[model samples]
Target chain A: MSARTYLDAGGRAPLHPRARQAFDAATDEGWADPRRLHAEGRRARLLLDGARESLAGALGCRTEEVHLSAHHTASLHAAVLAISRGRRRIGARVVVSAVERSAVLAAARFVADETPAGRRTAGLPDGVDTVGVDRWGRVDLDRWQEAVSRRGVALAALQHANGEVGTLQPLGEAYGHARAAGVPLVVDAGASVGHVPVQDTWDALAADPADWGGPAGVAVLAVRSRVRAVRAWPEDEDPWFPGGVSVPAALAAAAALQAVLADRERADPDRRALVDLVRSSVARTVPDVEVVGHADDRLPHIVTFSCLYVDGEALLTELDRRGYAVGSGSACTSGTLEPSHVLGAMGTLTHGNVRLVLPRGTVRDDVERFLHDLPEAVAEVRRMIGATGL
Target chain B: MVDARGLACPLPVIRLAAAARAATPGTVVTVWWTDPAARHDVPAWARMRSHTLVGTCPLEQPADRTGPSGPQAWATTVVVEGPPAAPPD
Candidate 1:
């Protein structure tokens, strides 16, 4: 077998060189709690403050607006619950795009169901008012306007870009509709923050450090001062997150963010071209396959396709045998073999789906090799399933 | 008639493909599938192989759950038009 190539880089990017350096330096110095009064605590405080400032500068938000959390899902839950709770007087309803992360949808559902009015009307059409999306996974702005304009919506949640399908949402218009309706929009920028340019299109933004070559322990949640977030959890010294995150991890995440951003102008175009190639190549070579995202308006590093008459798990196993690690969006690949809600929401084929996310330092030849092997792997899986001679 | 009611993705399509290969032209094969993946794949397979997909609708969940109709399966009717351009499966 050839050398193993890592193409499943969605939330598993290898740490950036800068992140490694930052982590090493911060580990020894930032071991103490920032809230403590000792000399060690002050050193840790400086690291945490510096990390927040750099992240704030990157996100175009005030340092005070930025808060560290345990992970991306934690940040999203906090944003959705806290913001919705803060504005409960307006209404307990949360307007969210259908294709937002499951965490966002679950958070919205929880906030709606937890309320007194919601308990009575839970699971009703008015509960967690969900806006639908197009076949390409773009949320319908017209429906969005109507959902947010409804009499009792507290907040809205939408992802900046979908990580699974790599489709970018029209945030400017989505945010505008919510703003006009006096609703705060919480944007999950996990998939777009490092790969694509961050747009000023959210009232509350939750970014995933792990998505951008940072460690997995910390995530960035920035809430604009104007946005009301009624601390959902018990009020502690740190209102945003009770225990706080690893200061060293936060610093390393910041450093990685800076590194990826600095290299964006040089890196994104190449990544985009490679993705475009992957998209076209899959469509051209593989029969009975549907490339599921918008061809033009998508993330620079991710692409997803669904193949008919093949099992995703089998195909992934075949590719693995061929020395390539790719991601899959199929029921068979998921431990429970449950269908993907993302694909289901788009009304796209959810079986035999393959997802490839090119890491920061992905090589061209490996991609070419994967493209060459994909047709055979797909064909083999198809044949194994008695779907041959097509 | 093919009842693919309980199987997930490739199985439903594979069963339907088997039916198409065995049947002569003008044979109408009905497959009832409950898995969501088959909802898209069955139609796609029909279109790809030139089989005629007559129509589809939700199965009234049996008043009581029982039997091999894959679980909440919908009935998909397809007419075998002819052999596909490629070699037989």
Candidate 2:
């Protein structure tokens, strides 16, 4: 396969040709609702089931364990709402990392505000609590343990790896903490699934195969049978999803996961080298740029840096014009600017935050081009900000 | 001058309010900040309080030069000319 160019892995990577072939094949089939039980529906069901099975096999879980959803955000909302409904009899506190994806955070807030006045608030309900993360984006385990030690804490959600900075969390330790406290843990593996091994410690795990070279709009929520969580809505009652599932996308997700895992051993080392190249080059090329994340204990394919005196929006735009389709708060949010929450949580500078997430089969030439182009981009942004003296 | 650097949300605005009250009429007060939200927030704050924004400048380099991680790193400096009010006693 030929190497395609992409500077933004957070949004979408250029689809691997083989994965693209599989995706094209999967989408070619008619869009029959899998629930109809008719011939076409049955075929859709078969594709859905095959996807669940392949995804489950790749993750080393049962086929029945996988629940497909539209995207990571939707899966997170469903899981949070499901857990909240199930644990309503107990309490409504949803302990989560302060730096969790905004989708999950917003859902928790919605539960808090919309639930009945006399009822418990959505997040850290009256008796519940929220925990803060450390500079490295790891939940302060000691603090989490302290919070969970208090009785009646119902549910906990933490990401397996941070999305922006790419810092891997202490999920195994968190799993032990949640287990010891008798609280069910929901791990958001959206950023970690195929890149790293997800511990079976989670009561429910949320992942997106696209993060590992899979198709978009397909995500999984793995709920352990031992954990009984009711769906928060009528639409979420399907057993296959424990909530409703998207069958076709699920099939594609499963295929993509299988492909990525099979190729991981060969791809990871190369990916890591690319990450290192970006990290080292940024440090050397851009003066006053702070590289954020756990330098060693992080996702092998992601490297993030914050360039001082440069507006993130301007920097991203310049990079885009230079043929590097990079991501920034400026681009993602359409220029209604704010510093990245992940960078803010890590206590790093956020003026010009840029992340380099390497797609599979990323080549030496692409990395070199990015390295050569990025410094100029940063310098241009700095000049525009009138801080060239620095 | 108001030192709002390292302060989180709302605090910078709060400090700006307090500084505005303490300044003499038409005196230019610079608010040093690192919060990205401030570019929008500070101007909104100045407008709300009816203060004239004289100019805005990036803190080019600290009087004491240091690495990026130190005090010299941030990129925004907001200058607000105070309203017609006497200095706080």
The runs of at least 3 residues in candidate 1 whose Cα sits more than 4 Å from the true structure, single-residue gaps closed, are: A117-126, B20-29, B43-55, B60-70, B78-89
User: For residues A1-390, what per-residue lDDT tens digits would candidate 1 score against the true structure?
Assistant: 569988998877888889989999999999899999999999999999999999999999999999999899999999999998888767788888888888998999898778885535553333688888898999999999998998878899999999999999999999999999999999999988988888788999999989899998899999999998788568787789998888899999999999999999898888988998999999999988888889989999999998987898999999999999999888888876457888877877788889998999897888999999999999988888878864
Reference-based lDDT, each prediction = 0.87, 0.70
- How many angstroms is residue A9 displaced in model 1 relative to the true structure, after the best TM-score fit? 0.9
Off by over 4 Å in 2: A1-4, A27-31, A120-128, A235-247, A329-337, B2-89
TM per candidate? 0.92, 0.79
Model 2, residue A244: what's the lDDT?
A: 51
Each prediction's DockQ?
Answer: 0.40, 0.09
Give the Cα-based TM-score of candidate 2 against the true structure.
0.79
Predicted candidate 2 versus true structure: per-residue lDDT over B13-73, tens digit per residue: 5566566666666766767876565554456456445676554566665657555653332
Query: For residues A113-149, what per-residue lDDT tens digits would candidate 2 score against the true structure?
Result: 5556566433335333667777677789898888766
Candidate 2 has a DockQ of 0.09
